[model samples]
Every structure is written in structure tokens, then in C-alpha cells.
Target: MTWTSYGATCSAPSAGYSASTFASAVQLLAAAQCFSEESLPDSSDQNFAAYDFIIVGAGASGCVLANRLSEIEHWNVLLIEAGGDPPVESSIPGYHFSLHNSDFNWRYKTVNDGRTNQGNQDGCIYWPRGKMVGGSTNINAMMYVQGNSEDYQRWFDAGNTEWTVEDVRRCFRKSENYQDQLLDQDPDIRNHYGHDGPLVINTFNSTERVRGNKLISAYDEIGIKKVKDINVANAFGAAIMTVTASNGERNSMSKAYLVPIKDRKNFSIMKNALVTKVLINDLNQAYGVLVEQNGVTVTIHANIEVILSAGALNTPQILMLSGIGPKEHLESKGIQTIVDLPMVGQNLIDHLLFPITVFSDELTENSEADDEFDNLKYFHNRSGPLAQNVVLDTFAFYATNEDAKYPEFEAYVLRKRKNSSGLKKEFVTLFRFTDHVADSIVELNQNHTLHLFLLSLLHPLSSGTITLSSNNPKDPPLINANYFADDNDLELMVSGIQKLLELLDTEYFKSIGGFLGRTRTPNCDELELGSREYWKCQCLDIVSTVFHPVKTCKMGQLESDSVVSSRLKVHGVENLRVVDGSVMPNHISGNTMAPCVMVAERAAELIKEDYNLY
Candidate 1:
């Protein structure tokens, strides 16, 4: 075919395009086909045939299970996702923020509790969950953090004997394929991670390396010393984050684990299928699922097991719908109760985020044409501003005291270019900030470069709940994220904000004329800026989730206190299991994607042992 026809075949514009534009379009089309479309397996037609395993929600954990369980040639593995395949934007690291509120996102908003997050729109924070095959992995910033080893120790100490620190470490390594060049220079760091695994982990090919290094030095000036690798150092200090991307593209769990085994004869995937309820019999055993797809409802049976990886919110919703939740709540909704697990939707926990904005004159905003050229650069060479998650790839973990081993707070720096026009929309849409709040941020960015220190309270004393809004499976669950319900959480957050404010006085920040930007809020108008009370007020008004929700289906020994056992099997229910972020009994010190992979890795081994597959 001629060059023009070849470009047309790849969906490039045939006319009214510059030569560079045509070439870039063709390159992007080829990359999408090679990296995503061609590697993804075709969705299976809805079938009533019984399978050995039925996995719900093709999310991070679910994708891992699909690959591991399907490794057995005799087992028929069916993985179902509510959304279709990830769009081309998901494969591009720079487009991560664009996935929010899109078709691939569940776009769930927390039920407004008048007590918290009042500054947000409708007094509620938006909770974005992935609906597609890779789930949140496709949409997340792609940081690969394993959290502190002590986080797993807390789980083991909480009667979860199967999740010891050593076991958790091994499982984390098992799923990791450490591809960062730092491994070649440092033996200790090399030994810290797995070299041969499905998930590719490397440092982002960031264009802002110079600024990142300067930021690291600034963090060091404020007592959070720079570390060689955050994972090797157990997240004790600041570092350029290791991420789950390689060669300028996002390596989502679907691409890392599922794509390699797409041709397996025993594996099957059902896309755009929403699982309404688990099919349970009178004997308290799950047999199948009730799925809604393409305006049709059907029952798909599982001969051996039914696994729920539908995430923190949906897993609990599905259990309650299946009559396996609290007796009072189920009966109130006119659903018969089979097993009264009172903690089914209780003890909801998440890392709460509060943004602290600062401004400087050193950074320059990219123009619209510059952004377009960035896209062209990425398409041509896979190296540009689009090659990384921008400033989100640099982070720091710190504790209140210098002697502490684990961090109480985590911070991610996001740079908003000076005079940028999208800052208001990002604040309003991505963060669901109110118009007043969004406008205040945009007004500041109009004059100077905005440096947002997105601070996360790693662990909180306050917890919330996820409950049924109605008996209807189609109805979204009520997410009562009671952030800062406890007074201690607010106090700690104030301290964390003070810690990050120290950056303003650092040499690196001072050299760039950095200064804290006062966020205009009605409640804090009278309070002195930078005061303890001012920070406290901001904590309550600006608090939202870092998108890590867990513990709705907590894992523990008692049926009264938790929903699943250490093996991840649902308590009081046979042939059913929950393997997702919801199974976390407590909050970890960092982002949750990597830990969820570890949970699935260990859960897979336990399943193999139970079934004698090894």
C-alpha cells in the first residue's frame, strides 16, 4: 500500500494534516495496536456452560487471579468486568488524569455527611473507581509502592496468621519484575525486589528529573532525607518513585498479567458484564452469579468457586445483595438473610488527601501548542512529557518523630504550570472541588507556577461504612467516608500539613521564590493563615480520598469482626472468596495498588494449596 493509504488504514487523517502530524498519528496507531489491542484477548460470548472458576471484576487483583488460576490447563477460568476494554488513553502515562469521570471510571461520589468535606461540591468527595479490565491500575498514577513491612505485621498481629511480614514480602517480590536500571548498580536494592515476574516495575522516564532532584534535596532539608529507593528503604524518606510503567507506556495489570496469557485455551473474559449478585443456595454456598449484560440478565454457574474481586465498594455491595450481610440491614431491604455477617459493610478505611498549594516563579506552563508537540514527541520516540506521570512520580514518606520506623504521612507533589487554563477544571472535575475552591486555585496559577503538595494521612483512627441504598442491585451503594470523624485524625493531619509547609523555607524552594498560597475558604477566613487552627479547618474542608479504600470486607479470625478468613474465603459461606483491597484490615503507609497485587499473589498460592494444584 502507498504511504498515504497505509496512514489511512491506521485511521490517520488523509488530508488537512501536516507531514509531522500524519507521521505521529500513524506511530500512535501502531503503538496502540501493538501494546493494547493486539495483545488483549477477545471477549467471550455469554454462555451458560458451567466453569471450574468464576471470577468477578477484572480489576487489579481479579486480573492476577485470572492469570494464575488459568495456568492450570484443566480449570476453566472466566473473568468478568463491568466495563469494556481500556481506551487508548489508558496506555499513555500522561493521560492518567483524563480517565477520571470517563466511561472507564465508575464515578462514585461519597454520600455527603454534613460533618466532613463541606467545602467539596455538595459536601461530598468523588470516589473514582475503574470499571475496565485493569481496573484502577489503568487509571492510577502508576507508582509501585509496597508500603512498609510493618503494615503487614499489623495484619498478622491482628489474628491474620497467614499474612506474616516475611510472607507478604515474598508475595510482593513474586509479582514484581524489577526493570529499573538502579538494580545493576546496587545489590541490596536488586535483592529487595523480584527480577522475574509479570509486572514490569521501573522509574518513569521523567522530563523533570532536574526539578525532581532539587525537590528531593528540599525534602532532605526538611528532615525527610533522600533515599536511594523508597521500597528498599521501607518508605522512610523521599525519592523519585518506582512505577508500573516501562518504555513510556503504562503497564496495567491487564497488560502485565492477562495479555501474556490471552491465548490460553482455559481462559475466558466477559467484558461489559455487571455482576448483580452471587448465586447462593440454602446451604450457604455460592454456586454462580447473576450477571447483567447488554440489556439481558443471565445466571453463569461455577462448579468449584466464585471469587469476588469487585473492589472495596462493590464487594460489600455484592455480598449484601447475595443475602450474606447483616441480618437487620438485609431484612430492612426486604432481602432474605442467609448468613448474618454484621461486619460485611462496616469498618471502611481509606487514605485521606488534603492539598496544600504553594506558588513559585521558576516553573513555566506549557502552551497548547507545546502540549500538542509533546503528543507528537511521544508518538515518534516514546519519550517526552507524556512518557511520565509528570510531577506525581516524586513522593515522600515521613513520620512525626525522627526515631519512628514507619511513616504516618505520605506526600505527592503535583506541579501546575504557570498561567495554565486547565487548573480550574482539574480542581473542579478531577477533585470535585466547589466552584469557589476551584476558582481560588486557578486565580493563583494565573500569576505563578503552582506546587501542590498532596498530603495523605497514611492511617486514620476514624473509619466509615459502605451500605445498601436499596435492595436493587443496580443502585450504587452509600459510601459514608467519615473522614476525620475522630478528633485525633484531624490533629494529625494538621501536623502533617505543617511538616510539608517546611518546604517553603528550603533553599531549592526559596531560590525559585516559592511561597505558600492561602486557599480562600469561608470557614477559615477569620483564622490567621498558617496557624494550627487554620490548618485544622483546611483539613476538614479540603479532605478527600487518595483513591485507596479498604477494610469493608476485613480479613480476620472472627466472623463477628470480619467478613473473610486469612485464606480470603467468605466466613459462613462455602465456595466463595473475596480477594481485593476490601480485604485489608487496616490502612497501609503508601498507595495500595502494589499491595493489592501482593494480596492476590498470596491468595493464589493458598488456592493452589487448597486445590492441590501444585
Candidate 2:
């Protein structure tokens, strides 16, 4: 019986549950096969009772690290993820949008600062982190971007020898697979990229090429020539984007690394086993993690070490809970302070993106997926528009701010709205005036609106911090994303919108005849271009985050000011290492996924090299 029937069976007559509910009574049975958690090694599997190394939070870092460290075939490695398992649909590329706002996402919201001059009074924005086994890697927009050279070199300049630009390039090379579409355009790009790597990075294959051309033209107008590949080093203008997909499907770390080595006798996974705290003994070294499963608290000791890959949000929380944060803060919360590291939860950074929406009366997303004939094709051939991501398309990189010489904002053009393809026939005829379909305007075609993602990169300048709300490990870490605290972040986004407006005035855009000014939107009318304050307010109202949170637990020699050291060991603490985004000393100017994977690789090497595990 299933959980539905079990729930019904447990209800009393007064509660309205009847005898008819007996059909699906699995919940009443209390069987171990309940689908709450992903399948892992059975508790009764005494053969896998303990491991030499146990990593927590099977995200981008944990999954990659687990697969790599467990490859030794002799040493046992157990990876634990608390988000449980994903529904079957989540594993498929077609159901990507459906997974959002559902169980698969972390669904974290912002702290809601009242400083915003406009918009909702709640002052919070919905921030979703991947809660499933693969973490955010499973749920991100799939943009594959390596950080800028200056970003990495800044780390070395700040005393992180392990994070020199060359070292980072080597790490990216180990896990990167350059796209054919990008390299094919320019053969000189062949040696520029590293193809034979673990991570599958390829360009999104689509039915139409309008978005790509638009991005290319936008960059040309801005005087930034498109580069062969951003990951190849120099990144300046909008070019075709490469995604982390394998054959038009998402290549999550679980699939790329973990599952392939699942059957390795020494490797084990404990899904739904929430590790509450890191157990440190008198030596102040991490001995093991304390986990709670099925109302039972079980302590699993790792003789060698414990790596915390819980990500930026939870990693710092875990450290503080394990008595490894600032002394005063921990003591006030009634938890014994193991190490006084003030910066454990400070210096949190994220990319805030403002959606610049414009109406297109000529073209809309080609959603042939809605047709009955297309349904047959998808069910049988697995081809056509359904196989492609509607949100995937061309991207533009350029400077939107006066002070910024490099690209400060990015635009991702889409022919189809995310998950909105099959719902309406409006997308196709929406842009009726554009070049591609203008000749067929008598057919009542509508153009598509541009979803301009004004991403904050290059120099965010402003930073935030993460702190523990309580000593309880169960409470979520308090996240205060001080977004838009920097003046440049606001100025740059306004410049980006103005740039888009400039694109509108071009003959090409004028020919289409659908201008953002005629839309009669409230905010657009209120926006005054001459004043910085007005533009800044507009930026705050329109801008949102790109879900790239990093540097919560920075690494540095200053133990009091840093969360972890260059070795990723928690400053002032022994045998405890942070192998996730938390170890970054500062924010990178790109998506954190690829960088996190690189960090995991470097972390594994650091652990192995330091411990001499090999």
C-alpha cells in the first residue's frame, strides 16, 4: 500500500477517513521502502557499517569528491545528503522547469530588507537552492562559465597559493568538455579549450537561431567582439553559451561521477541521513559526524577525516554548530566555542540579476511540443522542440556601468519562455514584425519579449554575511544577502537597461516596431534616466539574484578574520576541512558551479596530499 492509503487508514471515523481508504495503506505499514529518501546502503548492510572517509552534503562538491576519493577501490567513502531523493521526472531534461517550486528545490527566501524603495513590502525574494542529491548542479540554468583570470589571481595575491590562475585553469581542464558549436566556429579555439575531461560542456542545440544572432549583434553594437569561448581565458562579449548538459540532457554530478562508482564495494551513500553535528574530541580534531535517521541518533566515526561539502549556506552553519565559529557568538548561543573564527559566516556574496522584459510582436518561442503530432515524436523519437530547453539560447556580455571597463551585465535570449512553451500558442505569433516571420505577418504572428538577465559580475564590491539563528543544527542558517549595498551594482544595471534601450533605437529593432516604451508599464514610466537615484531604485526594483552564493567561509592566514585556511582546514581547528564554495576568499565573476567543481577537485588533492591517503 502507498502513503496515501496509509494516511487514510490512520484517520478515525470522526476525522472522515473511511474503510474505503484501505486500498493504499503503505503509510500504516511503516516499511523501510517508503520513498522519502533516495535508495542507499541498507542500515543492515553490516559490510558497509563504517568508512575511512565520510563526506556530508552530496552537492556539486560532495558528489565529485565522493566519486574521486572512492575510486581507490580499497578505502571506504560514505557520502550523506539530507535533501532525500528526487522524483523520477527531475532526472529528465524535459521536466526541468516543473521541478522548480516543488519538493526538489530548497525554496529559500531572502531576509527582506526594508531598504528597497519599491516593490513588495515583505522585502524578501524567493531564492531556490537544489535540495536533491545533486544539489544546485541539478537545478541551475546550466550556464558553464569559468571565472576571470583576475578573480583567481586575486586569491593568490590574498595568499592562496593553491588558487593561482594557472592552478585554477588546470583544475577546470580536468573536468571540462568544450562545445563543438563554439570551437567549430573558430578552429583556433581547439587548443584553447580542454575537451577530454569529466564534465560534459556543450552548446545547446535549438530549432531557431534568432536569439544567438541577436546576442552577437548586441555585442557588436557595444564594440565587444565575441570570443571563441569564455572558458578559454578572455571573456568580453556575448557569444553562444555552453551548458553543462550531456546530449541535450543535464549532466548532474550524481550522474557524471557518483552513480558510476556506486557499486564500488568501498563506496556507500546514506540519503536522508541528516548529519546534525561534527563530533570533535579532546584533540580538537574532527572524529566523525553525528547523524539522525528514523528517530535514532547514530554516530559514525571516520578514523581519517571528515570533509564538509555542505555548500556556502550550510557549511558555515555546520561549522558553527560543531563549535568552530566566532567564540563570542557561539558562547552567547549556549554552544561551546571550539574555535574563534569570526569570518566563518561573513563575506557572503551572490550575483543579483534584474529581469529586463520587453515585448516582441514578431516572434515567439517555437513550441511545437504542444501539438499532438509533436507529442508522438517526443514519446517515440525523443527529438524536436521538446528535447531542447526553451530558455537556452544566445547570451550577451558587456559593460553597463561607467566605471566598469569590462562586461558588468549579461543577457540570455530565449525564443521560448521557461516551461511556458506547451501552455499557450501566444509565443509563436507574438513577434509578428521580426525579420524571420515578417513576410508571414498576415497569419497573426506575435513577437517574443526579451528576458534580459542583468547579472552583477566583474565588480559586485558589496558583500553580505551568513549567521546561525540558533545553536540548533536543525534550524536553517540565517542568510542576510546585502544585495545592492554597493553603488556600482546599481549603476551598472541601469546602464545595462539603457544599453538595451539603445538596442531598441537601432534600425533593426525599429523595423520590428515593438518598443518597450509603448508598453505603459508603471515602473518604466516612473523611471527617470537623468538621475542616478532613479536608476538605482529601478535597479533595485527590477534586479534579482543569479543563485551564485559564495565566500561565506573565506580562507586566509588571519584566523580571526577567516573561516578556513588555504588548505581548506577550518582556521584554528584541526582535521576539519571545508571543501565547498565556502572556502573561496572572495566572489568570482561567473557561475559558481564550475568553480565549485574545481574547488572540490583541488580539495580532494589537498586532503589526499596532506594525509598521504594514496
What TM-score, over all chains together, does every model reach?
0.94, 0.83
- Model 2 residue 118 distance off true place after TM-score fit, in angstroms: 5.0
lDDT of 1: 0.86
TM-score of 1: 0.94
Candidate 1 ranges beyond 4 A from true positions? 1-39, 363-368
- Candidates in order have lDDT scores of 0.86, 0.65
**Alpha carbon deviation, residue 69, candidate 2 (Å):** 1.3
Residue 390 in candidate 2, Cα distance off native in Å:
4.2
**Candidate 1 residue lDDT tens string, 232-341:** 98988999889999888999999888988889988989988889999988788899999898889888999999999999999999999999899999999999999999
Residue 234 in model 1: shift from native, Å? 0.5
Model 2, 1-614: lDDT tens per residue? Answer: 22333233211111111122331231122221221223334332443355789898989999888988886667788888877655444433444554555666666666756664134224455567777778877667677777677778888999988777887888787877665764656766676567777777786555445656665675566565666566563555667666786444567777677756767877778776778899998878888989887677888888777889989898888888888887788888898987777787888888776544444454443443343244234333444443455554556666654555345656664433333322222222221112222222212223444443344554577788788788877776777888778886676666666775666665556555545522211243455543555556655643456778888888887886787789888766667788998888877666788889999888877777785764
Which segments of candidate 2 are over 4 A away from where they belong? 1-49, 179-187, 365-382, 390-392, 400-406, 414-454, 517-532
